[model samples]
Target chain A: MRTERIGDRGDLHRLAAQGLLYRTGPFVIRLQTRLREVTDTFARIYLGTEVLEDPRLAHFSVRVTASSPLRRPWGAQSQFWIDDIPPFEPYPRTHAFPLLEWGINWCIGTRAHRYLLLHAGALERGGRALLLPAMPGSGKSTLSTALAFRGWRFLSDEFGVILPGAATVAPLPRAIPLKNRSIQVIRDFAPEAVMGPVFEKTRKGDVAHVRPPHDSLARQLENAAPGWIVFPCFRAGGTTAVRTLPRSEAFTRLAQNSFNYRLLGERGFLDLTALVRACACFSLDFSDLDQAVAVIEDLASSA
Target chain B: MSSHESAALTAWRQPTSVRRFTAEQWTDALWGAGQHRCLARLSYRIEDAGCANACPEPAWDLLTSARYYPNFLQVRVAREIRHLHRILRARGIDFVLLKGGAYLSAGFPFARGRGMNDLDLMVRRSALGEAEAALRAAGLVTATLNDYDQHYYRTWMHEIPPLHHPERGVEVDVHHRILPLTSRLNPAPEIMWADAVALPATPGVAILSPPDMLLHTATHLFYDGAILDGFRDLLDIDSLIATHAIAPDYWSRLLGRAASLELGRPLYYALYFARRILATPIPTATMEEAHARFAPGALVRPVMEHLVTRVLPPRPRAARAAPVSAWLLYLRSHWLRMPPGLLARHLGRKGLRRFASDSPAADWPPP
Candidate 1:
């Protein structure tokens, strides 16, 4: 009988390689990978029989160990062995990282006293957080990636943790996962951005993660008051324009797009309503990234 | 003391006695054998609880089985309702609670353990001003609409523009009627007033009678064709009936109540579907009698069949047939939910409202 243990940093690394242990907050994640291959880039995760409980501790700790390498033609597949766990079944393929991140978010979100975890990419500039929340393909990630590169301090690439009680956005910055052609686009645009190796064809086509600038990482503990709520739509070849939307309409749109708005029920509604009331809202339609980034920067600077 | 004595002596040499364990004891022993299996298998996991804190063993363990999402939501909604009640009372405006909050106040447990979407309430037509003002005073901002549109909502729609609280992020739909913007079954608002019962669980928040609540749930499910997270609502109806043990006479009283209130259509739809889908124990004779009086068979059967197909369509497949069939079923269901006459009237009114807004006569009374 294989018994898993959570002892030290080395043990944590060993378990992470096996795909059985997940680290939450200092970051948030919902990781599920097999440990078939091990490398500097990929560690083999192991499964262990351990139950850890600590409040001031990060959310979610499951032990796993690395096994052997999973062979793939495109690249050496670094696999983590996740024993006694279920296989990874993610939607759109590349969504594995986001799903894991969301799971970690669920952990911390469930514990907060005043903040609510919202599904949106948050970025801070000039002491204010600009929330870009939208459904998939709504160009939120792309816009967030662009804005972060252009010096809008990245608060989070996913999840806008709205602290309506304090009227602020708490920062939980981590690796921003960019998918498909957008990956290359960001790489070319930034030129100096630190990004992870591109993993092809697991889920959510051609996925890669870009590490936030060191400055942004350093400021991860900083909080920004939410200043603007923008619903971004990416239309190829369309002119970039920002239109002020009615607060009421924006409220409705935000409610509809939220993952746990209904789950939070009346409080969720009231919290979101307060958030929109305190913030200016707009609908931005743009095909050009540079123009969008400039307008966002200007907006942030003004705020 | 021959062969038997020899055997007994051999058994005694091994052990004096071997206790035979019962099935229950054996099960307990088995469970105790595993290291973490007992702890892991102690409770069923709720997939959508939305808590991620897997530390602070006691807190994490409590949250793991705590029904925290709905419980947290219930507390939040209760607080908001208390605030809303204060505002309404301060202004001397009367209000009636509806749906989830209403159910909670009536001790129905907030949509059978699932969180509700928004707080629903009804204010009298004459007191819309007082109600709106009260909500505004309570920090709920009303959505600004164009003057004409605002007038339309006030005049024809069942509710005012949903009022939102800035910090709470909750929407409150203040309604004057129970049905659609264009439904023929216009029940008198006063009827709900007569049967309205104060929530036993929460003071100042009034809930509809069991029969009315049941009818409301059914009408909502059948008429609106809005079935997002409706399984929870259906479960509400089931629990309400089972717990109340509502009598057979209740159905007849409901039918009479519907007729007097001029809500025959909504009532008929509710009873029909409640019996069909939920297997609510209404007497067959009552259904048959109502069927004869309402004569809904001509329209109801096809509508129900269409809805049944749409709501529970065949599983998706690789073949084109499945997709095509689903599309057709969806169209059919939409048509059934709204008859051609109602649909035509709705579309026509919408078009007229959009294109021509100068004439006061253009504003038609709600169907």
Candidate 2:
């Protein structure tokens, strides 16, 4: 059998024509790109993952390539495509890898209504999941990455995929996108963390991706019941403060943080209510990574 | 219909076709339904038949994703209607919801996948300005348009230029009449509201009466020319017929209402095409009467048949439509929309503006 990994083949034309399927969670994205950086980035981040065979229909067929130089020679651009149609304006050529990552995220966030998709980071301990729901710049990613490298298995750094009509969350562990200073934070916090090359000067300034541990990738099929919900906030120099949140307040905050909460209508309301009822909810404010990790670990153990 | 053509349509009209669908056939049907923007309706139809459990992965994926947006819109439309009703009740502006808003308000089966670009509500022309003021006070404002465009809408269009909520991104179109004021056949708005039916869910909102609703749908499709939504409109007609034709006197009432509205010709075409294309059940006597009373002249009838059939169904993925047919219908729509002198001025100005815009850019770094 031909192995799922790309192995040694790195030719752009051949990859685009043949198509490479990267299975992520419930979705298998058939990605085709003529940009060298995008293929290289995909190869690096999705290092040990299986590549699905040809002729199997993918959930999303996407591509990224350079914009025509003749149109605008001043600045090179790369466009992301979904099913042959570009849904967004082209970005600078150096942003192709992030563009691809974001485009796939967009595809899942918009299309996958079978689950209640929250814009939150998730981690698992002893088959129990912890949902860290917060808006951007809330340090959810930083804490989740630290926990993933420490003892907890990473479920996902972006989406908290809670299956509709159930409380269990399916693991979709992919690369953790570390932004700006957090890139160095993770490197120093967990010296064993394997990360990719940093790409700077693009949107979401100075980003790199941390490779998910081999054990997390090995157990991608595992589904864990959500045990706790933490609303994390990072203050630069504040002491650690954790408070129990009322279930009703947690439900409202979670729905506000979800991508498809309103889209799922009554099903979303009922499912989220059930999830909030099952899990212990908290609001944590901390400045130190070690303190935040220790507090979260204690909470998970008590739950 | 050819055997190949019937494969897709058959899948749409009957649920059993889904049970027997090969993987390729299922993929093609899903693709065709998506192209026609009727996947939500297809989802409901298949689920009703208990075929959802057996759907192939690709079909299941398409159906679930397709169903969510329409369901979301359904909730939004309801909320928007309630907001509008609260705002307009004190002003005594009686408004009747139309199209998707109407179907959803009345809880019709065809409302399943009927996504709408705007919420359409028709008020009496005398009350139009008050209704506009009410919507404005409720935070719905019109998009900024140049003077000439504003003049065109205020002077000739049936509705005020569309209103949109700035923060919510929800569009609401308030209409005083159904057709454009300058169209060849103008149905009086009073006749429609005369027999309107109130929606039980909301106090102030109503829908056109059953017969008037059918006539309005046919006139809108035939006269306004809905190319992208042609299939959905036909499906709507089929659903309407199926829902309402059980009354013993419905056919005669429908014909009489169409005649009274000066819309017999459009109704005749709607019935003819609905029956032929979708296998919509039409009584033999009704079909015979429509043919005798409202069939077009020989030359126009054959030309319309060729163009309508070719252009109506969602074009299959591998198929190509005849360009001349679409072009002829385009001209026909404009001709039906306005008189010759106004048509010439409108087309001339539009063409000149398009030409000018297509010319080379003046310089880089646009202000």
Candidate 3:
């Protein structure tokens, strides 16, 4: 089906007034945001993703709006609401775009328990995806974005969504948020990358997003089997080091890095164990994005 | 009063009512279920009614997501129970699982989609210290409530202030009895424990016997706590009755158990509301006997009936509860749980603390 791709400012505002049903791979989001920055950033970064004119289902209905004047004056604060429930206090209005991204992530992390969600960035090559599971500020997003430009299909920069009881990985393929130094770092590294306006002083420091590769966004529905699990860390001025992670340690670390590991219980154990067994696990520490991409490419060839 | 409400109530009572639901009515039913926090149960009901295929894709999707969390919690609850039993059994302490824990452990149909925030268990009053110690030794700490709050819980409440497991991230409520010690009605722990039934599959854990379960659910719903969005508990009563009321002597035994536990009034309200609202099947004779023997005074009964109609159903997000009715119900709940003097002291202290510690203007949207 040919779906609308939210393009014009007037259309964006009109849809925001009425809820916009936006599809992101397996999940559908009904989003409403009056904030121009949010809508504008979404239009730029979410290009090529289908916007269902009228979707049959939306997993989440979310809104990002200004806080009451009594609490904070207009344009000073914004609240992220899901089904009228605000999970967190309001963020500054300037941070509306990032707040919406984080809020949508929160909804998926909490509600989409049907999939075993790993807090990882994923990219596919040769029909198998390499999962980069790491903590925040470990440069997962930066590495994922770098690889997406290096001929790897970006599955997701935020989540490695594994279908239940399957080693196959589904692509969320949303925009890769570039945080703080990574914003300028990505700009310098991939000059061709479409970057959104940077929102200064977000909760995560200066934040902007890189538009997902058009090819990856076009093939968002594509799924890949597990090929390798690479736990990567970016260290300043450090020699590039790659070590084979033990299966047991990989299992434990993967569980820890999962969003719904405990919630999935034995199912999580089975899936993670299967994933660890099926994949070649490694821990890579690199100082250079080019070197990191080189190491990952070398690892992918063997897979 | 609205057809949306009527449709929801009708669908809840007889799942076949789903066949007649228009798009708006179906959405309303979903909203009602979500508002009452029973969407999971509704999913089960829809499937049972064979309306799963008939329902809109969005409703089923929402239901699937709703059921997902509860299923997730169910597995965790089982693991937590197993761990707790391993610890408590070493001390020779046998505990009765309460509420959601009991429902899940006992494998009730209603347990399928029930979301649980914590695991509640009642040990013998004499063993309270030992159980608390056991939990503490296992690395669960009591919440760092203020001195006044701690004092109040220890002094008057049936359960200690909630305990938190730092690693597991689950709350555990340890109760030594059912009702407040100083309340006008004290349902003895012995009576409940005496009739409690052991979960066959989950050995070493027990739940209140069928009749005592209903009474305790009733007492908790109508007497023990703030009834904020408690329509779910009321559904528990209806489901329990629907499942167990088929036994030849269920109603008689329920009434007898309620009397023995000094929970006749709660049981009466439970039966009244369950039948009046959800159309739960109760023997006419039992309802009449409960009405005659345990009904409130004429003036009080009329007022309660009015307020209950307002408060029992799920309210729309935009609609406020009838403020006066809600406040009166709140006072009644407190009065039933605590004596007059203690109630005043407790409410006054808590009110003042709330006023003083009010979040810096930003906490405008209270959960």
DockQ of every candidate structure: 0.06, 0.36, 0.32
Stretches of candidate 3 exceeding 4 Å from the true structure: A8-10, A68-71, B6-11, B14-31, B48-62, B67-95, B123-141, B145-147, B160-172, B188-190, B198-206, B316-324, B355-367
TM-score of each: 0.48, 0.87, 0.89
Model 3 clash pairs are none
lDDT per residue, candidate 3, B1-367, as tens digits? 3543545576688887777666556655666677677888888988988988877666676776677678877777777898899889898898999998998888888788888889989999899999999989998888678798788789989999998778777788899998888888888889888899987765668998899989988988889753546788888999999878889999899988888888999999999988888878888999999999889889988898888877877654445656677667777787988889888987777667768987342212212
User: What is the i-RMS of every prediction?
Assistant: 11.3, 2.5, 3.2
Q: What TM-score does chain B alone reach in each candidate, compared with the true chain B?
A: 0.66, 0.94, 0.94
Q: Who is ahead in DockQ, 2 or 3? A: 2
lDDT of 2 by residue, B1-367 (tens): 2435734576777877777776546645766776677888888888878888887675677677778888888778778888888989978888999988888888888688777767989999999989899889888888887787788788888889988778766688888988888899989899999899987767777999989889888988888756424788888888899878998989999999988888988999999999988889999999999988888888888888988888787655457655676666777777888889998998787767667787632221111
Docking class of 1: incorrect
* Candidate 2 lDDT tens digits, A156-266: 989999987756998988778889999999999999988878979767888898888888887888899989999999999999999999999999999999999988889
User: Which numbered prediction scores highest in DockQ against the true structure?
Assistant: 2
Q: Which model scores highest in TM-score?
A: 3
Q: Which sections of candidate 2 miss by over 4 Å?
A: A1-16, A69-74, A237-239, B1-10, B22-27, B83-93, B129-150, B163-170, B198-205, B283-292, B301-311, B319-331, B347-367
lDDT of 1 by residue, A241-277 (tens): 8988899999988877766666565567788888998
Model 3 lDDT per residue over A30-132, tens place: 8987787788888888865667765344667789998777866656888999877789988887788888989999988987777889999999988998999
